[model samples]
Each structure stands twice: as C-alpha cells, then as structure tokens.
Target: MKNTYFLKAVFTLILCGFFSMTYAGTIYLSATGNDSNNGLSMGTAVKSFSVAQGLAADGDTIMVSGLIDFVNDPGNTATTTTSGPSTTNKVGIVITKNLNIQGTSSDTDGFQGVDTQTFINTRFIQLTADFTLGLKNLKLINGALITDLTTVAAGGGAILMTNGAIVAENVVFDSNTTSGHSAISGGAIYIGGSNGSGKATSFKNCVFNANEGTKGGPIYIQSVGNGGKITFEGCAITNNLANGTTGGSAFYIRFNAPTGKPEINIINCTIRGNKVTANNANGGAINWSAKTPNTAYVNIVNSTITENTTGGSSTAGAGIYFAFGTNATGNYGNLTVSNCIVEGNKTDAGVASDMQVKADAATGTAPENTVGYIAVKNSMIGAVTSLAANVPTANITDATYYNYITTLTPDLKAMLVRNNPDDLKVRYYTLGDGSPAITFGKSTFLSPITTDQLGKTRPSTTDISAGSVEKNPVLGLRKNLDSAILVYRNANNQITVENSTNDYTGSITVYNTLGQVVAKTAATGARTTIEKSLNAGVYIVRLNTTAGSAAKKVIIN
Candidate 1:
C-alpha cells in the first residue's frame, strides 16, 4: 500500500507539471571575444552563439551578451535558401540540443530597462530534435523566414519548432515577418507545420506585439500528433497584423491529426487591437479550425479580448471565430470560457462584433457529429453572432454573475496609453473607474495562471482588475437621488434618516467606496436616528424600499 501511494503521488506531481530541471556548465558568448579561447567563463568568452553552442552539451546554458547577430555567423546567414527541412534547411543557425539560451538581462518590457537585452537579429531558429529549451529575458527582432520553400510547412519567421517544447519567459517577438509570396504561416513562431509533431510549448509574461504573416499574423500552431499543446499565461497578444487574405490576425490554430487531442490554454492574458485585413476572413484576434478525426480543446479564463477588427470580412467574428470538422463526425473542437471579459470588438459594417462560432461543412464522410461547441460561463459578452444550439451558455447574460459596460460611469472604453507610441512597451488597458472588473475574479485559481500579464502579482491572486493592470476596488457607485427617501448627518455627527412616503418601509444601509457596509438600520416609516459616529467622507446610502432597491450618496460632514 505504501508503494502504491508513492506511485500515485508521483503521478499527481507529474500531472501538475513538476519535474527536476538542471543546467550544466555555462558557455559565455560576448561581442568582443575570440573563439580560440575556452568559453567556460565570461573572461574567456567566445564571440558567436554558434561557437558557444558547439562547445556546450545538452542541458547547458549559453549565456549571451550584446548583439548576437546571426547574419555574421558563417554557419547560417540570412541569405541562405534551402528546402525540405530534413535537418538541412538553412537561412539560420539550427539548435540541435536542449540549452537555455540565456540573455544577460532582467528587463523584457520590449524597450528600455536596466538589463540591456542581447538582441537576436536577422535569422530564424530551427529545431531538429525533441529537446526542451528555456529562453529568458531577451528580444527577438527583425528576424525573417527564408523564401526557399513555398509551402506552409516552411513557416516561422522567428523560430520553427519541429519538435520539443520551449518555456519562454520575459521575451518579446517584435518585427518578425515573412516574404508574402513565401506562403508561410507564422510570423513570430511556428510549431509543428511539417510531419514532426509539436510538443507542449509555454510562454509566460511574453509579448507578441509586432509580427506579420500570410496566415497567422504573429503565431501559428498545429498538431500533427496527440501531444501538442500551447499555453500562454500572463501574455499580451496585441497590435499584430495578419496580412493573409484568409484569416487569423493574432493567432491561428489548426488541428490536423487523425487521433490525439490538441489543446490551447490562455489564462490571465489580453488579446487586443489586432487586425485582419483580408477581403474575407474570420477572426480578428483568433482563428481556429480542426480537421476530421481530431478534437481541439481550448480553455480561456480570466482574460480579456476586445477592440480587434477585421476589414472587408462582411460577417467576421471580430474577437474570436472558430469551426470544426467538415460534415464528418465527432465534436471536432470545443471551447470553454470562464470569468473572461470579451466585448466591444468591431467587424465589418454589416457584420457582428464580439464572438462567433460558425459552422463549416467543408469535407467529410457520412455524418457522425462533426459539430463545434462552446461553453461560456461568467463572461461579459457584447454580441454573439451565428450562435448555434450546441453552445451552452451559463450566466452569460446575468448581471449578478457577469456585468456589462453600458454607461459611461463604469465605461471600459477609456484605456490608458493604448495609443501612446512612446510607451508601447508597457501599455495596458485600464478597466476605467467604477469598473465591474475590479475585484471580479476569485482569489483561488489554478497555480501557474494566477499572475497578471505585466509580470506582477495580481491584486487578487486573481488580477482583481480582470484584464491586465491590477486596480484597487474603490468603485464609485453611480448615485441617483431618491426623492421620497432622505438621509443625512446631524450636527452632532449622528446619522439621521427619514422616509417621506408611508409606502417606503425597509432597511437602510450605508457602505464605503470599497463595497463594504459600514452602517445599517431598520426603517419603519418613522424618523430614524442612528447614533453611530461617522467620519467625514462620501458613503453610498441604499434603501430597500417597497418599490425597489435604490442608492444615493449621503454626504456626512
């Protein structure tokens, strides 16, 4: 029994993604160094990342400094043109082992910080083995995908992951692109486009801001086998452009395997302001489709998707759009939304806005159940287009569980630094004053996805603010004067209340700005006086009248 219990415990830890990870010796690379010296120490560092990687073993660290320009590395240059990707594809240096490509920096806010990032420019990285890589505190900018191959398999403008997983933190993918005629998919990163299956890759506190591609503006993920997974926690997917005439401006996900379940998990992230400029496209922020015999699963929690646009697409799902199967059988794709704020997105002039789940009967055999389904719970939705009967919505429209912004008092439209080009690295949307997103999330949540996107502790373990920035829940209530009921403070600092109408008979309550009740009394049509000493401040006085519940500001001097 003890041995069995130990095995079960180990299995639980494994399922929870806990494992021992250790790195070997570090190989130092500097801009002003020579390859003839041993690269084990910083004093004797090598000049190139390629030479450092060649000297390091598996599970080692390649500490880089300054600009590690791949254009100068003779092993791989930006001008090489090759094809097939049978471990011989060129245009960049290919990493063949598992190594932590550590950049000497602590800042990854995209622009300026204390740790000057070791910028990687000019070439993309290809993985030929199933190795796990750890990337930390760096910026990959101005990388280009070679135009040797003309198929979608030749994807990934910045990186092409044929196999293995990469856990990246505090990284930024900026200004990566593909030659439009190349017909590639991913602009920032591509995973499992060829016969090689994708592994579980995760990015935490990362930014995918400026990338353009034909299919996916910033990223494209596919599963050729059962074990592919993509997880984005505390990430920002913003301002990307999907130039593809097809769709998927920010993220495009495709499941094309015959078996295996592919999954995408997005938590505490923000998908905003992306655009798809295609004549006919689907999602402005995200697009997903699964082929026959495969079921794709997606779970979105405590995130925000808003302000995304799709041009010329008459009826595009501006925020999120997806379909599954081709009239074949099986629930090819499923999505679950929990405690998320998805609203205020714009499509075309005549189309819908926020979210849409369309039906695709492209190509399939005798029907089995090739339909897609969505489960929306505790989410604020502005409009949903083409919602089918298969979608199960729970508390989507209920104000008690989910709140929408209809008035200016609690407006979500007022954002901070959203259009400021100078501060684009640290830009995030604010939930305006009196927002319902304040303190709206539960404190207890899953472990890894609890933090906010800006690499800070969420005010609630839980963004407390819902979207990105954590705001204090000092919501100012919209006060409406109730003529029949009057409440004020006496000269002696005692609270006095009266019901002018006989019909009004209920309890009266006073609360502070933090949604905490400070005082309460029972009303019975008689002049009531509460002897509780109150301080000088604004308080919301609520009355439970027979007509309905009402609240107004009762100034206490």
Candidate 2:
C-alpha cells in the first residue's frame, strides 16, 4: 500500500512537468478586459500588455486587441524606478522570451493585419533574451524623451534588442525621439551586443519615418566582439533626423571585433529625405564605422538613396560614410552598391555630398593602411566626391553620372525629376524617352536582379537600365526600332502589324505583364494579323527577324 502511494505521487509530478513543457498556449489582451481574467481566450483576455508579458513563456503567442497604452499600465508604472542592464522598468512591452505579439481584428482568432495608422506609443521596448521575437501587423511609435545618458549602453527610443532577434513585418516606427542626452543614440531601434547568439534581425515591409536620434535617427547597431547581422528588405526609411555631434540620419553601425565582421544588407529599400543637422555630420542616410581590427560589410542592392543632406561646412557623404579604423584589412568590411540609384544627396558648401570613405593612419607592423573599398557597379550615382583616393571604383558601364543642374539635356533632366514630390516614399525618377538610362544596363548585373525598385521587370532581350526604374519593353522598343513598323489593335481585338516599306518578314510573339509569352504568330508579308483573341489589357508585341528583334506595346479594346 505504501509503495503504491509513493508511485502515484511520482506519476503526478511527472505529468505536471510534461504538461508545463508541452503546453504552449496563446494569450490575449484587450482594452475592455480586466487583468484578473485568465488571459487564455478572447473572453478571458487581460487589459495590460505587461500583465500578458508576465504570464507568457517561450514559444507562446500574444494577441493584442485594440491599442495598448503602455504608459498607463499599473505594473509598468510600479517598476519605472527599477535599474539594471536588462531592466524592464519604464521600457514598454519588455520581451524576455521568444514570442509572437500581433494585433488582432477581434478578441477571437480572427487576426487583422497591421494598421499603419494605429500604434503603440511608449517609452521603448527591449528584447533581452537570445530567442526570436516576432512583431507583426502593428506600429510602434515611441515618444520617449531620454536624457542624462553618458554612453551608448542606454539607447533605443523605440525598440532595443540587447541579444535577441526580432522579425518585424509590416510595422511602422514613426516620430520616435532620443534627445537631451549626452551620448544618446538609436532613435527608433537599437541592436547592441557581442554574444552572437540571436538570429539576424529582419525588418520586412516596414516604414521608419520622422524618428530623431543623436547618432542614428532610425537605428543604431553595435557589435563589440562577434558582430550582429541586420537586414532591411522592402523597407522605406525617410524623413528621419540625426542631430548628434556625428550623424547617421537613417542608421549607424559599428563593428568592434578583430576578425568576425558584422553585416548589414539593404535590399529593395528606399532611403531618402533624411537629414543630419550637426555640423560636419557624416552619412546623412547611413554612417558605418569599423573600430580597431574589426570589419563590417554593407551591401545596398536594388535601392535608392537620394535627397539626404548634412548641415556642416565640412560635412561629407550625405548619402553614406564608410570609415575604417586602424588595423582593418582587405575588402572584409567593404561597401558594395549594386543596381542602385544614388542621387541629389548634398552636404554643406565645400563638402563632399554623395559618399565618403575614410581610413585611419596605419599602426603597428601592418603592410598598408587599408580603410575599406567602395565598389559601385551598374549604378547611377550623381555628384560623388570621395575623401580617400582610389577607394571608390565606379564601374560606369551602362551607368549614368550627372550633377544636379538644370542645364542637362531635356531628356536627361526629366529622368532626374522626382515623380511625386508629395510622397517621401517615392524614391525613383521617371526615365524619359531618349534618356541614356533606358536599356543601358549590363546583362551581367541584371542577371541577379529579377525586378527593379518599383517591382517592374527588366526588358527581356535588351539591356537593363541604370537607377531603380527599369524601362518597359515597349519604351525600349520605341527608342530602338524605326517608326515605319506600325502596331495597333484592330476592331476585332486582333493585333495588326504593318511595315510600310515591306522590308521585313519575321515571327511575332505577345507577352503579358508578367513577362510570359502568351501568343505567337508568323509574319509573312508587310502586314500580318495575329488571329489569337486577346483580353482587354496591355500586351507587348515582339517582332523577331534576321535583322534583329524589337518590341512594341498594344492595347486591345
């Protein structure tokens, strides 16, 4: 009897442990809900995000309904005076475990996507654990006024990740400020650590606007030993301000290791309209500094960096500032600009505007003082003056280079004009007819880039264009082919092709908007009819012959 009782107790304890390990549940929060509720369902949802944070464990999901006011949370207020390296006091929505926090449509399972207008306004949020935290379908607008800080240790006005990873999708960080501090930085988001534990933080389809930081207006990333990796994909960073003694109006990255280099990749992004107010500011859009022997790799691909300005008399690199400290080696920490548009970036009078690369004087027994390399290939760069000679190698093949001036040819000047001045998110200029940028890109570079900055496909046969906008196949054809080939849609919704001189016989193929060949027909005489019925939409008609191939656009009624 005694042995059976002891066995029953052991079995109960084992079952409890198993349930604790396996029971990953979803927690819900709502504005009308009470903290006394269980938070297990929509009806039992809690009221405060902090209350949900206290109950959530790793691998759990927190669905927040309505706007969460972090400022008025009783639990957050009670702990506002706490102090520590990973302190959650005063910081809003402190995430200590791997969890997914998303906004919901209702209190139930129906989840609404992120609302860009509504946001959680708070001091800041910190992720201290070495796990992946996901924030989706929500905006984080931090209005915290930080002061009396003397180091970069305490930063991140909007979101801070000390050693964790963050996957933020469709989020907006707007108007966050880190001011009145002696050494404040990272106005919007800060990722600081050397542990190299967390996965790379990725921001996809996010917007960062009007954030102000002493150093990095939108973001500041620092790696002391082993650096961190951050990627910005399809993100728009605009209208941010950097008022630090030194400046990175959009972001700042520092790598302080001797060997392992941190990496920052910007792909399909628009970084424009940011400003650096301090005199002698660097990188109105980005400032990257490599300390000691450490290295950092920055790749800007299929993006636009334009209209960023610095305020000082001797400011340099209003677009980007890449600095290499003593003891750095090779292209390990180089900046590569591929298939990008960098234009209209300006500095104060007598200052370098487009970009600057600097290397500290050599020390110890190093063979050479190699700061870093800046390679701009298959890109359109305007008004670039580098401080370090032989550092920037501009591969000008099929690339356009022009200073901001009104005296340019009418066609070229039209390509530099902004498409929409009212929208800060619109980064690319429209390529006009007879513009040099049309179909002038090299095929080698275009092979890797499937689509242009505006999500437009490059012309299939012809060369790609410089800058973010890829010319349409019809536009390229209009410039390449003679005006004798008349292409139009007939009354029967058929494509009619007529060569006036009857000098050519070729095959015709029709392509849809997705670059897929939809129809094919043979052209025997001067005039040929495509018998295939077509939908009422735009299509590209390609004519292939012994002479060459040309494409034209036709719309069916």
Candidate maximizing TM-score: 1
Give lDDT for model 2.
0.66
lDDT of each: 0.65, 0.66
Candidate 1 error regions (>4 Å): 1-23, 77-90, 106-121, 193-199, 327-331, 348-352, 360-371, 388-423, 439-448, 455-465, 473-557
> Candidate 1 residues 432-499, lDDT tens each?
44454554554443344445666566654332544555554444222222456666788888777776
lDDT tens digits, residues 1-557, model 2? 99999999999999999998998778998767899998999899998777887878878989877766665666543113214332322455566678888874212322221223543234546676677888777766655535553543656777766777888877777777776563567888877765456367888777788889888898887663355677887678889999975788987876555456567788767788898898756566888775545546777776668778888543367887776644343222556677676766776552436666665532222222233645666665665555434342242333334333222421222254566868665645666543444554554654654676566776665466655566654444533344667789988899988876577777988887667788898876789999988999888787776666567778776
TM-score of each: 0.74, 0.71
